[model samples]
Target chain A: MQLVDKDQVSKSLGGRLIRNNIMKFLFLLCTLVGLVVLVTLIVDTVLDGWNYLTWDFLTSFSSSRPENAGVYGAIIGSIWLMAVTAPVSIILSVGTAMYLEEYAPENRLTDFIKINISNLAGVPSVVFGLLGLTIFVRQLALGNSVLAAGLTLSLMILPVIVVSSQEAIRSVPSTVREASVGMGATKWQTVSRIILPAAIPGIITGIILALSRAIGETAPLVVLGVPVSLLVTPNSALDTFQALPMQIYNWVKMPQEEFQYLTAAGIIILLIILFLMNSVAIYIRNKFSKRY
Target chain B: MTDSQLKEDKNMGTEMGTEIGTEVKQADNASGIIESGQPVFQAKDFNLWYADNHALQNINLTFSENEISAIIGPSGCGKSTFIKALNRMVELVPIVRTEGHILYRGDNIFDKKMTVEELRTKVGMVFQNPNPFPKSIYDNVAYGARVHGIKKKKILDQIVEKSLRGAAIWDEVKDRLNQNAYGLSGGQQQRVCIARALAIEPDVILMDEPTSALDPISTTKIEDLIQQLSKDYSIVVVTHNMQQAARVSDKTAFFYQGYVVEHDDTSAIFENPKDKRTEDYVSGRFG
Candidate 1:
């Protein structure tokens, strides 16, 4: 007699569906809010910076008069800083990740160390600036040179690289490792040939992301007492340097309208560098990342 | 029995005919030695533990050279663990500990002088799942040789072709050797895994349910490959399928609750198992 009865079940099911749709719409609204803000910022920057962004402006040295001012020194200094930061951060992060994932025995000490690294990633970048000031800048006597700033930025971004790299390395299937070791591959051989290759895409992506963050960082360099305006570009790791973000920060604070344009231009250049870095990393990942 | 059954029976008896052909092979030295020649692997009182759990207890068995020995057991009975222990791959687990000696060519495999790397080179393994590397088929096959320092392109190419042929997958995959291994069907990938194992030229091949993940047709193909391979290399296979163990292996080892219930010629084990547990398990009773 109740075979065709659908009233109670259908009512509850329809109610649940309505509730689910409402929640989905709410989440979508939240996502759109963030996207809208990002789009507005990008559009505003492009509009403001279009006229000031030029090869001449990029190639000329900083000037007290906004008309002749260029980010040439800051651009070169950023390049030099990146040259030091990239290799150092990648080597240290990948090594630390490999050690924790492959070599270190699972124990309370390792667990504690892992937890500390994760927590360090969430620590404010300004704290690392202070650490650099106390350790590299003052204690080691490296001074406020490019090396000190680079090392400081490296310390600031190291946790991000290490955490992401660890995730990548950990995500590599154990079956591949077992297959390699089963074939009599030594530990180092397995790491170099099998594990490293499998994890390269993730490692490269993480490195680029970390470097991009470091490139745009100004707090640590500012705390390190890097000059707001440098006329000459840095040549060596030890040479004092200025980054694009620092230039942008200095220009944005000036009361002049032309300096405000320079700020947007600097922001656009930094965005381009970040975009290029990410695009190259994405291309490499797509080309080399195996589905398995 | 059918004609094919008779042929398989004769094939099974070839190893046991000389010694213990009529008698049951005892657990230790008495039956370990084959009158024909030395065994490829001889396990004596092999016990393993994961922390406090006794995974394998006193696993005493011998795998003859150029013969397929299948291990059959229910789930969680240490069949896979016992297979992994052959190549010392079980040590990957943090809490795993082992006792007793496994001898390969009359040498103690666990001796300090013989490294795990050396032991692994002699014992190649195929997993329960078809686990070819994510690289191209050619690269997957040549991975073992490359790790062993073989760098000559000509030699690697020849080895790859020969291994693919040996695993009976050359005809199917020869044209696509450069293709990624993951692009192939499950059966094709399994064959590639076997090809990879063959390329290493190990003395013993440990297969942990090589066909468990395959369909019936693919399973038959792998079983045929296993049969053909036994003429040149010793194979120790672990399987959950009793019928597969009966069909593919010369001898079947029955494990229950971390112990070897019985290990004998497949015919003997299936027809009249000495242990009650082995009979019940083989008969599809309680696992």
Candidate 2:
């Protein structure tokens, strides 16, 4: 044979091209599948709940009559829960991440700790609920109140926040760290000034996701014996509460057809609140991200 | 200096020692020259190990105050390691272990009482690649002083101006002080890094192949700046490019396989190196 087989090579190239085209089409389908389902669900809910969703539905509390029912108590109770959860979890998770990434020695122990932290993220939320029940509800005598429930949710998301924050901290370039340290700045100064600023976008993204998860979690609150529906809005962290997901879950369990419409309306409202919260977080992330 | 080297190499090392031994001739600090008699860094039989690998072996070199000293070496030859050791920047690597001493102003750099940050304050460093913090040009220059506790805006502005001027990039960046430093070209960014180092006013500035990443024109600008900065600060620069070392350094140290083959006046080292390896290296015989 000559140096190359021209006919066979062209045939193989054509076959490879067809295979790549087929794979490209398949990948597009994979990418759009999730978006397709999400849009379908939202459209169906909006169509079913459009008429029922109103200021009245948001202003009142649960009632025997579907038309008179609302999610005011649930909404306010969720707010109280998050208010307690956000600051406590953020401070704890970011501090842990900082210590692990910057100060911890590179050894078997730190690796073990890191692996366990990521594992904790995969642990069931109900287990955290039981932990909260033991520590906050029974032992600490906080009862089935907002503080106990919020802490339980915080615990559920702690591993997620810590792991993500650690990743953000790690993503900071070693070159920047060297430059800072080379300038005679202490380790703490380098971290606070250079690394934190560069990593802020990633850290903020982690916090936003964790907080959103905290807002929607029902299992931990359920394990803590949180009510399915609250007639009165919680005024403080020590008071009883119900989150949006728990409220929606309660409405779905109701037998009345009128309550079905109410459930869809409540979902829309929850989605709106989540949307608003994410918008603010995204804005902050964009502001800080531009510098790096 | 350690066991197993060529016998002729040891004799030349002691002969070179006499020149360094009598180099304590300059004492004044406010001006240039890296004057003799004041050894900013003296490595006496200094050896460094990264875990099991002997990275630098029995290094005996003296960098005088106010002089521009160049270390020329091939890859893995330990020039970078030696300069990093001068400021204890090598301590960042946890696996590193050292024997003997690299002294700065008569104090061993590894002395427990003297912290790394304190040593770094007196000895700033510029890396091979330009690395500017993700901040405004003004903020980048002012950062060293700011971290050291200079907060007043007026003083910071002055220091920033002085530093940029020192690095000779003030005219290019003066109008864009608020712009992000990453917006600058490679040469400008390197100058900003130099300015950032100058803000601290260190006694000795260690540069690891400062112009290896730049174009020829930019490299020339940096070489000129190095010569200019030598008037006030002692600088030890490591470069693989023989021409760069020849053009900028007053004294040249030739490193090969983790050992200094020769350390002598730049003219002598280039013209009549005693070691065959050095002569071969400078003559393009083999790196």
Candidate 3:
């Protein structure tokens, strides 16, 4: 019952080892390619924009004079956009996901809708901006206000949140559902009590990610015709406002060299916000995962 | 009997031997087959289909109150399906359709007047795998009570304690009621699930291979618990292990190919099955 002698085994293992090592090295090289580019960009941005990240630079608004330019208005505007976007998108997406997964009848029509939603997630983000431009801005007459931009970006990330929420809801064990129903729990009781609690961690994580994507997006707001810069912070949702990515985009286009540094600083600011949101997501997921 | 004897019996044209059992059976239309207790649930000409496939056909059986009824069959033989049908939980499947009536306490369960929630409150189930919800042990046991709208903490505490004690796991889990149910061992989790079902104070308990996932000691523990619980509630267990059915049940129903081949007193069905198929299944012959 010996398949091979020890020496032959070792010889063949050595040959297999060569193939394994080659593949391993190739994967590592591919990984490092992305890593190296990201690190270089971050390091270069830090170095180029280090002097521009002053308190005065942060406190003031964007100026024609490059040295006095700051992202204060853009920061406030991004917050406003998110304030409108987060609640509207999370509610709509989660509700849609719940309906489709829980209440919808099983048929080709539902299947068609589910497939089209997934396809919509891959559709270009700017198309959603045009959709918002037509619906919210023109038809609804909301203007190019923060409401218009917020609704636009919300539409863009709607599919992403819907997909993630559906996945979270779907991941709840059927056994748990059976147990609940077997206990004489009504369908609503089972969903609200068992299914929702289990799915909240995943749904929250999805919402945070979708919000993160919305915050960093520039093209949709740009197409919505949000001002490149604003003088004052938005006092209401309907007020005209600037956003972090839009500010950076405008700065990058300016000929002044300092505006280039300002763009790098804006990227750093945006990254910090994203990193914070993602950290919260991971924390919530880990905490809830341990409880179950 | 030997193969030649069986062949000769077949040639003599006895139709599967269901007609001539030693005693009056559930399969018979006689209303007084059960000797002592009243039948809590009965399936009269019950049939079920999963879309075009007939999954259960003309199932007739009676489960009496304050007794344990065992449904024994091989895999995919509709044992679990029949048990689930008792509580109307089988309707959850999208393609499932059923014909004929399953009577619960002499009321037709398929009648539109019997809401699913009302029906389930009287019949609870424990699954093959231990499915403890991702919540506190107290919450897990209290789940059924809470669903019925008992929100008082004092009442919930009493119910939780009673249910855990009823399932015979209070000693192991009493100290950790605040802890997560998932933190327990597999056997304890199954007990917790049982406790959860018990919290509803159901009239009938349906268990689908409740101990198939457990060790020998755990299985024995649950078997003892089932015996004790039967004094209060009617029980139906679907099991692949014939020995477990014989050990734990008062009545045993043998199912094959979605038909109830034989149902009688536990001893009689095991020792003197009239159906050729039932004898073959019980004696380690081909299922």
Query: How do all the candidates rank in terms of DockQ, highest first?
Result: 1, 3, 2
Fnat, one value per model: 0.88, 0.76, 0.90
Candidate 2 segments whose C-alpha is farther than 4 A from its true place: A290-292, B1-37
Of all native A–B interface contacts, model 2 reproduces a fraction of 0.76
Q: Compared with the true structure, what per-residue lDDT tens digits does model 2 show for residues B1-287?
A: 55556777878876764443223212111222334648889999999999999999999999888888899978899999999998888888989999998889999988898889899999999999999999999999999999999999999999999999999999999999999999999999999999999999899999999998998678878988998998899999999888777777788999998999999877677778999999999887987
RMSD after Cα superposition, model 1: 6.4
lDDT accuracy of residue B124 in candidate 3: 88
- What is model 2's C-alpha RMSD? 8.0
Error of 3 at A26 (Å): 1.5
lDDT of 3 by residue, A3-76 (tens): 76998887799889999999999999999999999999999998988888889888889888888899999999
Error of 1 at A198 (Å): 1.3
Supply the TM-score for candidate 3: 0.92
For residues B83-106, write the lDDT of model 1, one tens digit per residue: 898888999999999999988888
- Candidate 3 collision pairs: none
Which sections of candidate 1 miss by over 4 Å? Answer: A1-5, A12-20, B1-36
DockQ, every prediction: 0.72, 0.53, 0.59
Clashes of each: 0, 10, 0
Whole-model lDDT for model 3 versus the true structure?
0.89
RMSD value for candidate 3: 7.1
